[model samples]
Target: MADITTTELRQRLQAGETPHLIDVREPWENEEASIPTAQNIPLGSLPEKLDDLDAWKDEEVIVHCKSGSRSSQAKAYLTQQGFSNVRNLLGGFTEYSAG
Candidate 1:
């Protein structure tokens, strides 16, 4: 999986790209803060939620959590499941929020 830094992701969004963002954080964490465009699917529930992301299978999908760890796992799983353009958000939401 590729690592997408917060600044790069922000620039891409600013450029009008609608990349698919998957939040692997827990629902409560997401409720506290999240990117408005991201789809919430807690890490534990990702396997079951795979079908929901099928539409984005061929597109660039950026996975993130509170930190980067969970997002890495999510990226691996998605790639194993044949997702062609899965990326892990570097430093995850923490960095994004900080920026």
Candidate 2:
């Protein structure tokens, strides 16, 4: 899996680059705030919800969580599940907020 910094990802989104953005954080954390185009899919539920992300299998799926850890795991898992393109949002949402 590739890794993209928050700033780079933000710029891409702002510039009309629409990647398959998935937020692997919990619902409550997401309710607080999230990147505009991000879809919610909590980490714990990802295995069961894999089909929901099937459309993105061939496309690059950007994953994020509160920090970078969970998102990294998510990226790895998704890749192992046959997702060809996965990128971890380095530093995740927390870094996004910091910037």
In model 2, which runs have C-alpha deviations exceeding 4 angstroms? Answer: none
Candidate 1, run of 10 with poorest lDDT:
1-10
Which tens-of-lDDT digit does each residue in 18-38 have in candidate 1?
Answer: 889999999999999998699
| Model 2: lowest-lDDT 10 consecutive positions | 1-10
In model 1, the Cα lDDT at residue 52 comes to 82
TM-score of every model versus the real structure: 0.94, 0.95
- Cα lDDT listed for each candidate: 0.92, 0.91
Superposed Cα deviation of residue 47, candidate 2 (Å): 0.9
Clashing residue pairs, backbone N/CA/C < 3 A, model 2: none
Over all chains combined, what TM-score does candidate 2 have?
0.95
Candidate 1 local distance difference test against the native: 0.92
Candidate 2, residues 15-85, lDDT tens digits: the string is 99988899999999999999888999999999999998888899889999989899889998999999998
